[model samples]
Every structure is written in structure tokens, then in C-alpha cells.
Target: MLSLLGLLCLLHGIWAAPGDLHSLCYDFTVIFKPVIQQWSCEVQGKVDEKSFLYYNCDIKEVKPSGLLGKEIQRTNTWEEQNEMLMDVIDVFKQQLPEVEPKNYTIRGPLTLQGRMSCQCEANGLSNGSWRFSFNGQIFLLFDSKKRKWTVVHSGARLMEKTWVNDRDVTEFFRKISVGDCRRWLENFLVHWDKMLETTGPPTVVPNAFHAKATTIGPRLWTLLVILTISVLLGT
Candidate 1:
């Protein structure tokens, strides 16, 4: 019985999905504050002095209504990806907080304003040399040399590859840039790039999530066994 209880405890602990929102708030809200505000846009949920914190944030839009504008443009360091993803998602939830959060889609070779992208407009808007316009999209790029995940505009390009290595990074881009439209993206990447050290890439697990499930097999059997022992001993 004791052995069974120990095993149950271990399994239960292992099965449980641990969370540290406070830690998240500390790392993202404090350390990566600028990153989120820089990449993403904000949609205020009734702004006031009291609700200032909850007013606007970098997050995936709640729906068609919350769409701010679109992922206009950007670039990022090849090394600093994990920090980018965690920070971006934290901001996304600030606006679209949900129980079972479903991550948005990511595509590659995505030509912004090109006929390829699902949300691409007929007349693609173009920056100096980056993407055009894509709203409510998320892009993810993996650098084999750097071993990091980078988030950027939906149709961003590097190495002259149209969509070969690049994936859609709309929301990830949105989570960082909010109000300052004139922010120099290349300068930002240069500043953040200094912190990059050689590190393995982060693994992305899709669909499969760690959720709580009731483990009653042992509990139920234990009760029966205990009852049986009592009855047998009494008899």
C-alpha cells in the first residue's frame, strides 16, 4: 500500500503541468518589456487610469474586431528566439487571455501581399525591402547555424530566399512593436544580438499539451482493498 502511494505521488507530480505566471511576469513583463511593446500592437479594452495596465497589449487579436492593423515590418537576432517567443506569447495573452490557448498558424515562403498568403491583400504594401502587410499572422524561422527561433513579419526575407528558410512570424512580430512606428528594427536586433551565445535550438511541440487528468485507478482500488482487508480481518 505504501509503495503504491509513493508511485502514485510521483506519477501525479510528473503528470501535473507546472506554471509560474509570476516568474513569467517578472521575466517578460520586466526584462523583456520593450521587446513585447516593440513588436506587437495593442487594442484597449476600455482604457482608463485604473485599467491602464489592461488597456492595450501585445498579443494575438481576440478576433476580427480586435485586429489593430497588421504586421507591417521587422527583423530580429538569430540567437535570441526563446526569449522572444516567451515574451511574445505573454503579451498576446494580455489581450486575448483564454483557458485553452491555441497558437496561431505559421507558414514559409510567404510572400506578403503576394497571392500565396491566405490573408495577402491584392495590392501588397512594401517597405524598403521587407514584407508588405499581413494582420493577425505569426511567423517562425529556425536558423540551423545559430540554432534559434526568430519571429518577424509575415513575408520577411533573409539570404535572398523568398520563403525557403522563413516562416510566417506575424504575431511574434506584433507582440514586440506597439506604438513607435519609427523604431529602427536593425538597430534593435544589433543591440539584442550582443547577448546571444551559442545555444541549442528550442523544440516546438504542436497540438499535444500537458493537461490535468484524474488518476483514480489507485485511489479506487485502494479503497476496495482496504475494505476487503477489514472485512477479512473482522471475519
Candidate 2:
């Protein structure tokens, strides 16, 4: 039937959506806490094979991005963003020393949604936490079927990762690497990537509940029996 066909098509379409992200890199969301209570970042949107575009978010800043710098193990507070900013600029100056520290505001609250977790080197990993910054707090939500990458994870399959908890958020950074701007960013993002895994929305099949009126119903059953008898007699 047309109705059944349409229903099938709708389900198929939702399943076929394209966004399959690998857990390699990341994008970040930075906030000017307390007074402004706003956060934004430089990276956003679907990333190409080579690099990622900038995007931002307005979610809980439960943890800092670790994009600009690694958060040290201490009491967390809103006042630290500016200090983090200064430290980041110092690292930045070391790398591209010619670049002066200017107040660069975050772009906007983008929807670069992905798994929210961390992969620290202290877990007995080989490399130090200095390899994934260029792609910090930024990873794509990829669709395996279509091979397309998207920034937002609204309908896409996600890793069941949540940043709601402070413990999980703290793991996002280790060592507070002011080592170098580029390498430091990579280190933070790599751990974030490791934290990304398939936490699903749980796939389910579509089905029709009621196809038609049942003959077992009193009125319908009587009508069918009478019609059958009449047909038999007439025949």
C-alpha cells in the first residue's frame, strides 16, 4: 500500500544519513566564564580529509577544551580562562613569536557535537600528550554508509559519551602542556579521540501495529460468516 511504502521510505532515509567520524582529531569550545558566561571556539563543522573548519557550542562548560592548553590538577574555577588564555599566548608566541597577543573572540556556538571523553598518556600510552592540538576539542561525526562527515551529532549515531560529569571532563586534559602551541593541542585532542567510541541510540526495526480489522471481532466475524454462507449458496 502507498501508506506502507511511504513509512518504509521514511525509516530508510533516517538510517541512510551520512556522518561517520573517526576518533583522531577534535574541535574545542572556549568560554569567558562567570560575568560573560559565554564560550566559543575557532574550529567548527565537517572536516575535510586534510583539516577541520571552526565551530562553537553553548553546552555545559563542565570542562575546559584543553584546546588552548591543558588544565592542571587543581580546584577548577571560572577565573582561570583568562590565565589559560595568557599561557596559551605565551606558547603561541614561542611558536610564531612574531604573532602578537590580541584579543581574539570565539566565533559562535557551533554544533560540533561528538563523543565527550579523554585519552591521557598516563594510562601507559606510548606517546606524550602533545600530538593532537591542531584538531582540539574537535572531531567529526561521520556516516559510515555515505562516508560524509558532519559537525553536529543530533541524529547521527554517537558514542553515548556525556560531558555532564566532572570526572569525565577532567580526563580531557593532562599535564597542562604549555610545551608548544601546535603539539600541545594535538595531545589533548588525541585523548579526546580515544574517549570516542560507539555509544549508540540503539537501533530498532519499524513495524505496523494494526494492518486491518480482525475477523475475530464480534460484528466483523458475524458479517464474514454470513457473507461466506450467502456466497456458497449463490454459487
Candidate 3:
């Protein structure tokens, strides 16, 4: 009886603990290629619920021998992280023109330092389903009502949602394969450049690399997992 009680307690504690991530770090450098002029921007950020969230944006060689950069630091709760990232991006958008207005240069091989958290339950949309695609190479169809996470590429399935832990979800992410992701990256940049050139560039081009979109690569995708519940038990 004592053993049974202890086992139950252990199971509850595990479920109550925070999912893998305490902080998330993203760092990448992009070199936009153009004939007349070129642009290179490096964005780095560290975000967490308890610690200070920091973002550094660096624009190098906007003009011959010119450099521009900005840094932001703030602390926020886990629930606030999604909004925090948007605010940082907005700040970068506002600052890009100061560096240089005319140039098209972008390259990837972006990086993520820690686990990325996604919450399916937060949407409050009962039984909603969404298609998750990465550069059109990898796809996941998540059925919130059914609590099903499917791997479109491999035809693998996580049959039970509550029983699914970080390790189980992470394995599904790996099945998409890193090679496919690299191909996606190359294909995406080609189309992206064409759109930019034709559409006359966006209002602000900071050479931004979105962590969620870029997660097709092994380095980034490996860190992806949905934290089903908030951190109820402190580690």
C-alpha cells in the first residue's frame, strides 16, 4: 500500500513539473544578397519566465564601414513570452531604416539554444485542429479534441495525448529528418527573395529569422515540445 501511494505521488509530481524549457535562446545571422548593395543582420535573444529576456540586433556593413545595433532586456512570466517576442521584433522593425534602406541580402543556418514551448490548450478552442508545416517539408496535424499528434512525413502517431511526454514528442519531431529541412530552407529563400524584389521590399527588412518557422532544421526542431501544463511544481 505504501509503495502504491508513493508511486502515485511520483507520477503526479512528474506531470506537475515544468516541461523541458526554463528559457529559450535564439541566435542567427542573415546576409541578404543583392547586386547593387547587400544587407547583413544578426539577431540574438534569451527569454525566460523568471530571468531577464534579452534581444540584440546587429546590422553590419549597411554602408561602407558602418554598423548599427540595439539591445533590449526585460523579465516576464512564461505566459508573457509569446507577446514579448513580438514586441522585440517590432522594435527591430522600427530600427532597421537607420542602418540602410536599400539592399537585399539574407542567408540562414539559424540557431536555437534551448527548448521551445508550445501550448495547444491555451487557445481554448475545444477540439480544434491545426496544420503545422515547416517550409512545406515537414507537416504535423494536431487534433486538439482528439489529443492526437501525427507525423505527416513518416505516418507515425502518438495515440494517447496525456501519456505523451517530452521524449515522445521529441521523437516525432526527429522523424521528419534534418536533410529535408535543409532542402526546405534553400527552397524558401529562393521564393522569399523573388517576392521581396517584386513587391518592392517590406516596410522594414531586418533579415529576421523566426524560430518557429525555422524549426525544420534539426538544431532548432530538436528543441520543439508543447508544454501541456504550466510549471506547477518548482524544480
> Judged by lDDT against the true structure, how good is candidate 1?
0.26
Rank order (by lDDT, best first)? 3, 2, 1
Alpha-carbon error at 106 in model 1, in Å? 22
Model 2, 229: alpha-carbon shift in Å? 77
RMSD of every candidate to native, in Å, equals 21.6, 21.8, 21.1
Worst 10 residues of 1 by lDDT: 20-29
TM-score of each: 0.17, 0.20, 0.20
Model 3, position 182, has a per-residue lDDT of 23
* Per-residue C-alpha lDDT of model 1 across residues 16-59, encoded as one tens digit per residue: 34420000010112111222333333321110011111212344
lDDT of each: 0.26, 0.28, 0.29
In candidate 3, residue 7 scores what lDDT?
Answer: 27
Question: Which runs in model 2 stand beyond 4 Å of their true positions?
Answer: 1-82, 94-118, 121-127, 131-175, 178-235
How does residue 220 of candidate 2 score in lDDT? 46
Please give, for residues 175-233, the per-residue lDDT of candidate 3 as tens digits. 21222222222232223223233333224322344223332433322222112112222
